[model samples]
Target chain A: MKRLWGPASLLAILLVVALMGSLALGEVRLAPSEVLSVLMGRGSDLARTVVLDFRLPRALVGIAVGASLAASGVLMQSFFRNPLASPGLLGVSTGGALGAVAALALGWTANSIFALPLASISGAFLATFAVMALAKREASAEHLLLAGVALNALFGAATSFLLNLTAGRFEVSGQIIFWMLGGLENRTWSHVWMALPGTVLGCMMLLPLGRSMNLLSLGEQGAQSLGVNVRRLQWEIIILSTVLTALATAVGGVIGFVGLVVPHILRLAIGPDHRRLLPLSMIGGAAFVLVCDLITRFLPGELRLGVVTALIGGPFFLWMLRRPS
Target chain B: MIRTERINLGTRLRDVSLHLLKGSLTAVVGPNGAGKSTLLQVLAGLLKAEGAIAWMGDDLNSISFPERGRRLAWVGQDLHADFAFSVRDVVAQGRHAFGDDDEFIDSAMKALDIENLADRSVTRLSGGERRRVFLARALATNAPIHLWDEPTANLDVRHGLDVLQLATKLRNEGRAVLISLHDLRAALCFDQVLVLDRGHLAAAGNPDDVLTPELIHRVFGVKARMGQEMILELP
Candidate 1:
């Protein structure tokens, strides 16, 4: 427990810096002093509107989304006992993407702001249930992963079909493509509210299961012999991780590697004890997305948030694979 | 003290009944498909069989998982430690059922002579060392009943002897120690021997009586002679 303090402190510091950077560095480019003044309720109306109404909600959403995805990743990796497992391993992201794209293609986004996220979450839940149903007989981690893979392919194909149908309508096709690429642009307090409560509640529930998850690393029968309720733990992990992934994808629109990369890096830095790894992954994940989102702001010509993360995380993951453990 | 009556598991194990006593070291010996592992797993409460497994006259299923865990410490065959958890971390997991016990973890590691490797990752350890780490993990449980499936499989000769000595020590402490063995010679040191042939209890009693040359040949399908100190197989 004592060993966790240093890395936890470092990640906390990085999260704060990233949050500040996200608030200060944007299209309007407020100075640190001005950002602080606006935060302190002493700035001009324009600065106040930009900082308080716009940047704060966007930054908060990034933190919540990042933390949610990373924590979800930790759960998936530990539950499956496979480091390669991520939030998308269960098809939640693709399912959510399909729902959001279908909504946009069918003109549901114009109905209400909540329509996109609600549809996305419903789609994610359906995909997860489908995977569960397909793998219900076996219910092993390997079987669930295989089921997830099959569902992911099906969902991806369906998303493409929607894209094809909307090809003649440039506006609809463009919106679909933009949502798929993923960005935190024009995010509001509603997005923050949509993500924060569930992420906080889900992570809180997952934190105490760390020791049981450690026992789970010993294999199914090994863990069972150690008094872990393997079946119950499996259900808890599936529900919690799926909810987190759906919430993040609903708001962030398929932000990819924060889930995979954050947990992987934190596991390397701090040992594989989920007690430390889960919380650190939360902080690390939020910081990673915030930093990545900041980079999107600096880059020329409309680089998407998901594109930047994949660009960075893909190469880093390849390098990690090349390096021997 | 543990007792089983007419235990059966899908074709793997059938009608195997056995009794174990405190302060005794018992060895379960059988061929590859002889259900030795299935018996151990059933006894450990990791598998449910058709018949009754009672601990001190209480039905095994009646005991809660945590209570059962505190009573039985199981070391499975070919258990994999794929993650880079430190040896100490893995050993500490033995105390998980009873909550944290650094003293038990330390003593368990020391008993297995793995104190120096406590900080090393279990994933990086050799087969023998990894086996010791898992054995230490079971030892850390401080449970009265220890169920080990092929505990000495990957160990060197000295380590194998050490494990036998540790089992004897545990038995001396008035705990029941049951191990499944592929090494017939090691079975000689046990107080009682159970010879399982095709999920049946072919023979059970004092090792000297149960492991007779004729019984060995009948159960194991091997012609053997009991030499001065070892059993020799004949073609």
Candidate 2:
């Protein structure tokens, strides 16, 4: 759709410039022309490797990871109807991490690239399922949020216990740590391959239901008058959010705060119609994750992407939480 | 276009039998818990109506969801929220069923006099402003049937008159508007009134003949008298 032409477009244009900077400002510092050549398939070996093999994959991961989290964030926020709701708030990220750890623990995924995301997806699905089962009988936004908090705690406990049990295994432990902290250190095209399908699928499922979501904001009884099949839509949304979250978590482990911050900022800018809101969130999310990845990869050190996001988002989150309603 | 016979909507609606015609401003008036809202929901294809709501003489449930949404527009209660949206965005929700028709949205915004507020956030609007925005959204749906759950609740007296006058205009345009109102004066101004008392239909007819002193006393448990010009004076 050729519709978005306001704050969202400016952000998108800025992202394009930032993406160019991201490809150029790394260790080797390739010129824009060199980066273009590498993208267009005719560059020096180091430029090609730096831009295509290393920086390109990293940048792509940033966009995908950011977008997936942001869209998932928007969906979950709308799903729970709480401004504070996010993938992290609901503990879906932790659950997916545990699933990735489980896949590692099984020792069957050492050679398989799909194992991590698949496990994360399953874990995310299970965690959300547990939340749903606990509060299904009296399901309100508050109850659902409480259920997410409780399940998040339980999943955290389980993941910690698994970490404690597998303390000596470096490969498994390292994978778990990197996954837990979140990173795009050596992400390949295959990682991009895995994340793209589900994110696209999730977008396909959720955007068409945007009007139904608007009806939902009017509250439950209000929705029924608009012919909204509330239960069915709720289920689809929960599952779609889980799937998208899992895909991101599986590819890059549990990145936090993109879901929390991006949609909210965009909502403040564009308001709450999912049609406009969701698209803006996608652009903003991609920008946020790309910026974070730029910081993590080019800023020199073992500071994990997850840790960087937490450090940035933590104060912002608390500031948001405490800044008076 | 709503026909219900022996459709049990639990406690609110008990073995109700009613047929509501289209293209007139029909007021559903009652006290609290009179099942007026429930009946409106049933007619709008919102509730899990067991019996049929024949839309143009076809089974309502048998049709698809999008079709139903395009056919019926509902203005619900308690629509206020903490989340801020522009008056334009909120009103654009009505045209959602119309499949992104910009022409429809442009005129709908103009009709509701919310064109100036298009860029302004809805959270900052006054009570009457908010109510008018919601009404504008419902109108933008361009559906033939409109169900409003106290559409004039928060409006000032002047705005309330505007709402009623707008309803009259919509009705005259051959659109069906069934609104539930606690205000008897507003109900009297409507083309027709359906009196509900304790989840049962007390009476149904023109505002004058149907809203008799006896029916008023029976429904509201209040002594009432009528004078010339069909003015109702109540105690």
Candidate 3:
């Protein structure tokens, strides 16, 4: 059937508009033609730096982060096969948060821009392995989610305890606050250089598996009979998704809603075909995060990034969750 | 063709010998909870059974997934249609293992009389229609070896008979079709028969000699009476 957006294509359009919105509707606005001129590299050096150097990286990073989070969300939802499944709820973002918080506390991230992502990737991988081990032997959706909850609570409490201990002693109060809230602020070409490669590579790995995942949606036994090696497939996706969530968090700091909410909305629009669903979410996720980031920059008063995302996402997520089964 | 030797892997299948020739109709019949389904899955290599399941002297597991798709097809009990895919999509998925086989898919759908329901969503189909679609998918594989688990379940008398008749036709066309049946009356039409009870082979061979009233009573806890036309029925 010909669809309105087919979820995937609709998200692609939204991503372009959002990218334009980020470039044109910033604190200092620019015209669409000016943005296009800058995009095409024909604009003056001042416009070029202002557009390409300042806004382009921000917009591109938002898309990268958004796509990463959305892709992570799809993996979690498919692995658990639950609409409510999100990287945040499953403690994956929490792992990234803990990793960032740890690097800040240990004074390891001060020397290089790379330390944050490196530490965060390590933390996320550790959390993933711990949960996998805890739920191994007889793992199902419920058991995996439960393990995620336990890890989330434990890591959350530990992160808070560390913050409380360093509230005065470390003199890193601002860093702690930023670590918790999540942002795309002051993100430069260096951060992009570090994160974009892994994010793109991860997507490449995941895209091929989309058709295989379509088979998996029929349940593990169904995939197995169709010749899918279930355990290997599960582990591969988990590892790939973990890396994406970690790198995004490492680069952009725990951006919420994009990963958790985008896929559910897309699924409702397009019947689940991962070949279509995965790429669609990539574009949709980028648009959603970029819009939220732009809105946060001029929200009347000083607004925390996580608070802005939460204010918008919390209500929408609850509504989606409460929709009749 | 499909071939298996005295391929017993130790103690699991001492009495689990099966010799299904090409173009023969075979039915494994028993009451509920019998190992009939298990045997079908094992022979189809969906399970890791002790006995060997060889297709033309190639170890079953050694064959690639797509290769097996061209040679053996299995329809398990309690099928899961978790996605909201159109019926055509579900049928088309069967040909996924056999690339570029739209001809096979069209013929398979025709065989099961599901051509009319091609565009209908699988989740919306009635039980009988769903069975036919699944059967069509199996046939779409164009496999030499076909295994079906209670293909007649939930089907009305007519659909049940249609399922048996179609299976018979496939066998006549030189496909090794193994069906697990709860209906003994249908088994009377199959060339070879095996009855299972509590994971053991209760009886095997031609329906006349192996499907006696005493054996039926012992395995099913019910009396079987040979009526006017050698009908196997409960008293």
Q: Relative to the true structure, how large is the alpha-carbon lDDT of every model?
A: 0.89, 0.77, 0.76
TM-score of each: 0.96, 0.85, 0.86
After superposition, the stretches of candidate 1 with alpha carbons farther than 4 Å from their true spots are: B228-235
Candidate 2 CAPRI assessment class: acceptable
Worst 10 residues of 1 chain A by lDDT: A134-143
Name the top DockQ candidate.
Answer: 1
The better candidate by lDDT, 1 or 3, is: 1
> Which window of ten consecutive residues has the lowest lDDT sum in model 3 chain A?
A1-10
Please provide, for model 1 over A200-219, each residue's C-alpha lDDT reduced to its tens digit, 9 standing for 90 to 100.
Answer: 99989999999899988668
Top candidate (lDDT)? 1
Q: Write the residue-wise lDDT of candidate 1 on B162-207 in tens digits.
A: 8989999999999999999988887988999999989888989998
Backbone clashes in model 2, listed as residue pairs: A117-A250
**Per-candidate alpha-carbon RMSD to the true structure:** 2.6, 4.1, 4.0
Off by over 4 Å in 2: A1-9, A21-37, A40-52, A89-91, A105-113, A131-143, A167-175, A200-236, A270-273, A298-301, A321-325, B102-116, B189-192, B202-235
lDDT of 2 by residue, A1-325 (tens): 4345777779899789879987898668888999899889898999988887777777787787888889888877777767678876666788888888888777758777777778888898788777778888548778888887887888888888888777898877777777789988888888877887667777777777776787676566555544566778888777777777878888888888889888877776666777777767877888888788778765666678888888888898899889654
DockQ scores for all predicted structures: 0.67, 0.32, 0.29
